[model samples]
Target: MPTTPRPVKTVLASVTAAVLLAAAAATPAHAQSPPLRDLADQQGLRMGAAVASHLLDDADYRRTAATEFNSVTHENDLKWESVQPQPGQYSWSGADRLVEFAEQNGQQIHGHTLVWHSQLPSWVENGSFTPAELTQVMEDHIDTTMGRYRGQIQTWDVVNEPIGDDAQFRNSVFHRVLGEDFIAQSLHMARAADPEATLFINDYNIDGINAKSDAYYELAQDLLAQGAPLDGIGLQGHLISGQLPQDIQQNIQRFADLGLEVMITELDIRMTMPVTQQKLEQQARDYTQVMDACLAVSGCSGVTVWGVTDAHSWVPDHFTGEGAALPIDDDYEAKPAYWSIHEALGGDGQNGPDDPGPGEPGTGTCEVAYDFTSQWGQGAVVEVTVHNGSGSAVQDWSLTWERPSGEQISSAWNSLIQQSGTTVTAGPVEWNRSIAPGGQVSFGFQTTHAGAPSVPGGFSLGSESCTIR
Candidate 1:
């Protein structure tokens, strides 16, 4: 769901298995190269592809998918709308087709999603069911679909894109009726249906540690604390040219520290169309960077690209002027990005999982500088610059400091603020969640008190105490 511009309109067509293997004979560029799956297996990774049922029919596409990938995620066939279009009624023909292909090809089936805000059926969206009724509807869908595919699939994106960039829960129909608990409830239901399937909360813009990711981090912690059935975090590595977030490894590490698995679930780097060789090379580097980050973190389950070829890439329609996102182009030619990833996975029979792999940036301290932007009478606007004094990157941050006596935060911007006595905690909003090495983001708030502006004392970012100014 790499920031979809519009909804996917149709379920892909079905393809025969014979066509799948035949594509290998066509031998697109890099046909001489070793399969990506073999290289990934050496490193204990599940190299994956997001597949539409129809793509399996194209000889080259099918050959590449079945040969190069060890895992397959249904691009759209497994979603709620595609599976259950009406109340209590279900359809699995499309999803079954993909599952059968994965099994036939000896690939692990990674279920795309069980619940998502978009791609939901009309009944679920327009049926103004009460909160209790909607809860049943959601649980029923989970039981029906997940029950059908129980042990067949390895993972399920139980909840997807639940948190928006604003660092707040998205206003999906589920949220409208069931509130935040909807998330935990969905996970619980999914777990009940498929006890063996790994359950994940997946999102885009979370490939790096940032505000939106921070929100998920917080939610994941809460869910775990409550003993809710959450398993992994899916980093939808939907990247753009020259804009890879710098803290990918750190982000993955922190999530791993939480004892949850992580996966680069849907990765693609889109650039402006009519592409150049330089851009493709850059894209290759970006793809390698992502795979490298996955390798650095122990709990990272694997990496899965969004699609097999650019011809069917969603970029052209979703992102105007942007295409050529996949490693393979429309004509089944492997781009530089393909070889870059191949090299990262140890290239044609080179290194194994024991290798230290590539290096990653180090972490350091975070510091904050505060100032009163404007003051008049009892009201003053205060801004604090949270600097990533750390040599590495700082992901979704929490800034806490002690306010002067009787001072109260009236309102805030660029952060989520909470006050308990003189201690104030301001976490990032969506925009300012991450700070690259030496980079900084500032959040401001209006305060009311009897005296002129006064500085807060003893700021801290997460557990790291900051030098306050």
Candidate 2:
């Protein structure tokens, strides 16, 4: 059942987007400047893609992935064959390559899962596991795998797709033998292993609002109150065309209300076979709606698309009849959907209000965003986005920002940058310094904001100040 109006209806909605943003800027002239933006306006959402084992070995594929995403999720990184292929002889070949590849490129990594009934080994399935045997096996698996990547990986989808659409816990081996306590123990064991990596209970139906998700919410709340070591919730938003839920933003926010960071992980909007312009437009709108929901929620940390390019997307393989779930098409070219994402991210192209041309300095030609639910009130997070643009390798760089009075700088993350009063500084920070003719680099700043008002400045590798409103 489709909830939103058809494409013809949203075209008008697009018109209002540019106008509203224009009015917000201080200058009446700029405000009335017919709506302008580019791929720069979005906040700190880690746009990403899924990678297959076959593609991981290609130099070209790896390079493209580095450019397109900040984070990468391996589809079968922890499947039974890769994790515990033999009864007791676990192999880390595939997962190792993924972790190594991600690290070398300075990208974030997410361990796909520790437990999923679908991909487990047959031994773990019907192979004689008494209650004690299962519990030990579970603990050993969690401690071994999670502990291996303790400080490096960002998060883990601890337990995936455990609940049915009907809201009852799915009756799997873990449940039949270990029962509901299985969920709690799994998370607890995971926390005990890494303690640093964020642990999430992930699933698909919990993405949009509905009876199915309502059940997810209630269950999650109970888990939290009982002191389950849960730090995040993952909404695997596998949305399809003509079927986006309208109250998605509110739904994401509701989960954040439970005092945990929420992420749009494993997000890939699917569609029926034989795609079309009208269908593509609808897909863009769906992406916009999801990104907008993430932008509005405070505790919402970021959003990660399931795959970066359609050539490597899993939609075609997994779904009965769906393709074009990614923003980039098979050839790694940008699609209408890509522009739509940029638009939702405050881009200036057709997908946005006013798109910028190539190599525009300080215009955020290359950048990263942090869409934290709350602002840096009296505290601000300063982020530096560095780009090689085209034909440059940045071995070294520098940044200096002029701040307003009465604003004290607080703590910072990714300490590659340095700060100075009214004028904060970063860089001369080390890098391979070669952007490979057109490569890019970026880092973030978390500072306290003040009423005095300020817009960030001091960029290098080619730009100066960003267009601050």
Span of 10 residues, lowest total lDDT, candidate 2:
27-36
lDDT per residue for candidate 1 within 226-328, as digits (tens), equals 9999999899988997899999999999999999999999999999878999999899889989988999889998999998878778877878898899988
TM-score of every model versus the real structure: 0.71, 0.68
Q: Candidate 1 — what's its lDDT?
A: 0.77
Candidate 1, position 34, lDDT: 41
lDDT of 2 by residue, 246-293 (tens): 888899888999887898887888888788988888888888888788
Stretches of candidate 2 off by over 4 Å are: 1-42, 350-469
Scored against the true structure, residue 335 in model 1 reaches a CA lDDT of 82
lDDT of 2: 0.62
lDDT of 2 at 61: 48
